[model samples]
Target: MLRFQDWQENQREVFFPDTVAFKWQMIETFIDGEEYDRSHVITESKWLAEHVKQGEIGAQEEYKHYKFNFSGNGQIEVISNGFTVKM
Candidate 1:
């Protein structure tokens, strides 16, 4: 999951990026290690592009950065072809 802020002081609550960038990169920093309370996504990912250029991933498929931030927990990041949310 990504680090998503349910509520910001001056900005509207953002659940995800306005536009999906389709990229993924692992982040290794967190203020605290605890349970995850939110998630977010970023499109037009640069990480995916780098991997494509390095031949680490295929160019035929599209991937997006999936961030699962620990709400109260290391932020885990990964690349996904696609995702769906079921409330």
Candidate 2:
């Protein structure tokens, strides 16, 4: 998962590295009350040309699947779309 400070923060265009073999995008949807909810989905742009290439960090399916380290208190919550998704 990607860490976004706010729903709007995820709305801009992004890219996978030249090495990755897929496409992905992050988006947000506004539901009932006031907040917004965000989601990331893999968009098909390319697939790794070779099976062995998949293991390299550069060969992940999509840019979004790349890992990033997050550090914080054990309880973290996202407030959005008038709902909260706890992590």
Error of 1 at 18 (Å): 24
Put down candidate 2 lDDT per residue, 1-87, tens digits, no spaces.
223444344433323324333323343322244223323222221232333255543443333322111222111222111222333
Q: Which stretches of candidate 1 lie over 4 Å from their true place?
A: 1-36, 83-87
Candidate lDDT scores, in order, read 0.51, 0.29
Please write out the lDDT profile of model 1 over residues 6-62, one tens digit for every residue: 434332232332223333334444334333545555456566677777876678865
- lDDT minimum window of 10 residues, candidate 2: 73-82
For model 1, what is the C-alpha lDDT against the true structure? 0.51
Alpha-carbon RMSD of each model: 9.3, 13.6
Give TM-scores for every candidate, taking all chains together and pairing residue i with residue i: 0.45, 0.20
